[model samples]
Target chain A: MSASIYLDHAATAPLAPGVAEVMHDVLVGAPGNPLSQHAEGRAACAHIDAAAEKVAGLIGAEPREIVWTSGATESSNLALRGVAEFIGAGARIVSVVTEHPATRDTLSALAKQGVTVDWLEVDAHGAIDHDALAAAVAQGPDLVSIMQVNNETGVIHDVPAIAEQCAAAGVALHVDAAQSLGRLPIDVSATPIALMSLSAHKIGGPKGIGALYVRRRAPKIGVAAQIIGGGQQRGLRAGTLPTHQIAGFGAAAAQAARHGIASQPEWARLRERLWQGMAPLGGLLRNGRPETAAAPFLSVSVTGVHGAALITGLNEGEPALAVSTGAACSAAKGESSHVVRAMGRSPREAAATIRFSLGPGVDEVAIDAAAQRFRDEVRRLRTLAEAA
Target chain B: MNRGAADDAIRARFLRPTYAVDADAVDAWPASGAADTPGEDARCRVFLAVGNDGRLKAAFAAFGPPVVIACADWICERVTAQTVEITHTVTLADVEKALALTPTQRYAGLLAIDALSNAVINLGQ
Candidate 1:
């Protein structure tokens, strides 16, 4: 009861086992810049290369295709903006309305700069309609940007099918795999994704480090460099590489490749357990179809309770449950979830939604404790409402 | 007041709203007054009652952010067990001062005082 139960993994997961140690070793042992030609620099470059290979291995990409950036936000900005800049004015990009703000805001900025964008609407369950997507693709946009998974609802997009559609249409597809990297299998070789944005923290790697995979194969995708100076990462990104952070990211990716995929069924089981524990409350609305969502995520909106009060009660109660009402980025603004609203939920329902994203170290005990806390807070708030 | 500090004050009051009324206890009070500000996004209702001895008691139901709920809770606690005349004297300033409500939350104090005024008027009638 003293320790808080963490279920906000969609916001960021705890660092995987040995990731911190790997980072510590790199920080203490590697002191030279990777760009320098000295022996020390060569040593540093070797670490970066090794880390790159590990990360590339996870998604079936070559080490040369990985471009490191500052987490997924920067990766997304670089990918989308770079493409928009390369395509010049009048370039149209198709994406879903429910994408993370990193993608959405970047697209909005691109739109302001004269790039046309077609924002596809999602259905009530937060899944994009295939016919609408096909229609949009047939219109011949220069690029298609869609998240492999919705950060807020965990709704899995049919990326392989979408990739096929885009490929047939001669459109380059960019998938934001930030939330889906470890939770789902992604093979660039198997799927025709032209560009992919990845975040380390989402998969138990350190924060402040992410990667963008730019395909080097046939059809030859082109992306203009958004960050200038130092001419690093083939001038795609210029800042000096963070060796320790990259090392940690690599370790996390290695761990996920070795263990995370095999752990999905257990994650799924725990997610269902959590849902069942809270289901008896009777007025719960699952935000998206569970079958269509990633196994580690469950979002539910409560009826008969003040949204803010319910969040407060759960967060402040004994055995505090760490959960989010929406995307963690938007939660700080105290705004209702745009994702849920886009899914046709009323603002009130969106506000009352809680996203419980499980990751490493989450167990049945944690799930049951979180469920008990959720029930207690919902009942208390509902009773308080009834009395009033 | 700093927004974080104000939020902290509101959170403290919101987590333990001791004077919050329960539905089962409504029948025991003799005199009652209620007011509500209705909206799609933010809604609040305050219910006030006077004891047989003319002492005031209050409770509230709100569908708003923490600041509004905390304001109502603060007003109820401030006026509880006071004479009806004293309870009626509670003002927007008093609630605001107690809760350190932000400017956006100032409406909550006004809503609380309106409910209290209505209760006092009901008791007089």
Candidate 2:
């Protein structure tokens, strides 16, 4: 079939129809720059503000707390770097090695600049050790960044617990929450995070647009503003924001806030069917605790088979299927995900792992069919290997 | 084949696009279908049989009992204007065991809403 089964939701999700319609309407009706002093411009600005409010509402914050950025990378950088400069001085930043490259590299650079950094150890399941975080925060660091979810393994972290530790230390918590914002709940009141990243693409909004949740009255975690421009995003981010992207991102955030749980049942059902299908095959290992894992993702490793080959085999069928070996952004590098590595997997097993992510187009029928395809492909590939 | 015979002997099964399936039609065909026959050609489990640009785009596996495992495909007769989505590959043995039909019956064995010409057809080219 020409269509591949789409199981790559972690990389980016297909735009939901609701988000698409809103974007299309805004694109056609209001093409004005949101900052211009005209009726159309005012209308555009209103649309953007409403969208921002929608995004803020999802995380239980006021609209003004949301500062738009390019996407997860910029949002992440803004939160971490923003905190560093806002404090008007340097301090320690504790993060995990399992974090996305955005946070991982950000902290790495911070370390080079002599920022005290604590790269916490994770259990085999990729959970951040709370005691480690508590100890690190107890050191009186000014800023700490952690993700609400592990991108590759879909492991949910204890953001609230970590935030509590940071609060006790009078430290500001910056949650790279790009992965967990819509897939799971993230009420700022519950986590009380000083800074959190949000991405529209992850919630079916267009790419290149994200925002940071900056709490009012948050303790100063001064960060140097990287880009100097029109000072558009409340001096947090500068440059004329793309109205279309901002509008779309806001629209998607609103939708996620409203109906995020509606599409969840299908994912749970699909995962159950897939779990049953894959459980029978020997040498098959499911990576995370399903209950704690994200609804749409299931990372698994079949002994004696390369995850990439397995993906190819599954997609090579009718009702075309799609799957992935690891994070799409980093898959081309041919390295197993660092998140998987943090879970204590041997390099070979980690390399052989495949991630099956479902989204709007997926259902139990597709997943069950895919599970069979997965088994069939794994059997064929392993048999060939043994024969060779 | 007359309408009565076609109706009584064969019926088309409706499957989803690349839908999963397992039926009780494995008695009519030989043990190892095309791929495992150990004949001139070694069979493939699943891969693209036709380019996507073609009318019939799909992938499949030929297992024992002449079964077929395939992504969903449309089976249709232009004249009849009848179309059915073929989700799973039915094995020959499955046809025999499930329907208890013989080859002589022709279209009476494995017929769906789509085709009448090709009976016991596994994967489309």
Question: How many clashing pairs does model 2 include?
Answer: 39
Residue runs of model 1 more than 4 Å from their true location after superposition: A1-3, A327-335, B1-6, B38-40
Q: State interface RMSD in Å for all models.
A: 4.7, 12.2
Q: List the per-model TM-score of the A chain.
A: 0.97, 0.93
Model 1, span A255-323: residue lDDT tens: 999987898899899999999999999999998898999999998988777677777777776778888
Task: Give a tens-digit lDDT track for model 2, residues A1-388.
Answer: 1365677777788887777778888888888888899999998898888888888888888888888888989988887766666654456778888888999898788778777788898887777778888888888777788888777778788777777778877888888878887888778866658888888888889998998777876653555667778877677788886877888888877778777767777787787788798777788767778877888878886666544444545554344457667542212233666777678776556666788777777776777787777777666656433311
Model 1: interface root-mean-square deviation in Å: 4.7
Q: Which one wins on TM-score? A: 1
lDDT of 1: 0.84
Candidates in order, TM-scores: namely: 0.95, 0.72
